[model samples]
Target: MSENGGRRSQAQRDAITVEIGYALFSGAFAAAVVFGAFAGPALLFELPGGLETLLLRTGLVVAPVLFVARVVSVLLRFRQSPQPSQPGRTSPDS
Candidate 1:
């Protein structure tokens, strides 16, 4: 028994799992990079209180946004591609 009531094969499940893992990993990496870019100066240098607060807040907002964007983009792109989960769908590009 599986999540899909055993409707899909083990291979299909495995593929989906891998794709999800990839999406999460990429999202986390992108978020970390964006956060670092935004907060790096604030963290590294001794700046005015207002400026530091602004930079930190901006990083907090932007990082999450980028994370969601990356995850959704990857998953959506993956869904558009050919998959064994949906055997009949050969994808529009093909």
Candidate 2:
């Protein structure tokens, strides 16, 4: 029984670690995409006209602000959410 419990605990820890790893990877990927979308045109193509330069500059400024706002909103929603109760844990109010 003790060995089984230990195994379960270890599995839970491993799962949590995997989840955190995925979250980090996803965040990195999102950041890279955001950066690439805004910067790729400027770096990869020669701007033949002023309009293209203006558009790229505008996107570079606006995209990061929008992305940061979205991230903050999601974090706020997570913070406001109630956590699930563990199986053996009792609420203090109970």
Candidate 3:
């Protein structure tokens, strides 16, 4: 293949990698929200607090946990995968 064609293919592959990584991360967050929302009541009951508790109680803990996990997974993917030398398809450095 010509250099230009190879470059384009590489760019497409890199873009796909980044997009799939993001999708997985987003799915994790969505799952966390749904899990925390439904399980919040029961889970919160386990916590020692009165009825004054707000949604933040559940979200605060769950959001960070989920976000951290997503970030870590995405980072891992970038680290494990070798990126192609293509323009406009740079993977995250960190």
Top candidate, metric TM-score: 1
TM-score of decoy 2: 0.50
Candidate 3 has a TM-score of 0.41
Q: What TM-score would every model get versus the actual structure?
A: 0.80, 0.50, 0.41
Tell me the tens digit of each residue's lDDT in model 3 across 1-94.
2367545576567776886778577857776876678457756566445532555465666766777677777667765786566656866883
lDDT of 1 by residue, 5-93 (tens): 76877786787799999999999999999899989999999999999999999999999999899999999998787655557666676
Please list all clashing residue pairs in model 1, or write none if there are none.
none
Q: For model 3, what is the error of residue 7's alpha carbon versus the real structure, in angstroms, after optimal superposition? A: 10
For each candidate, the alpha-carbon lDDT, in order, equals 0.88, 0.64, 0.65
Could you tell me the C-alpha RMSD of candidate 2 in Å? 7.8
Every model: Cα RMSD to truth: 4.7, 7.8, 8.9
Best by lDDT: 1
- Going through the candidates in order, what is the number of backbone clashes in each? 0, 0, 0
lDDT of 2 by residue, 1-94 (tens): 1367545566556655665565555555566677677767877888777856776777677666666666655555554666455757878888
What pairs collide in candidate 2?
Answer: none
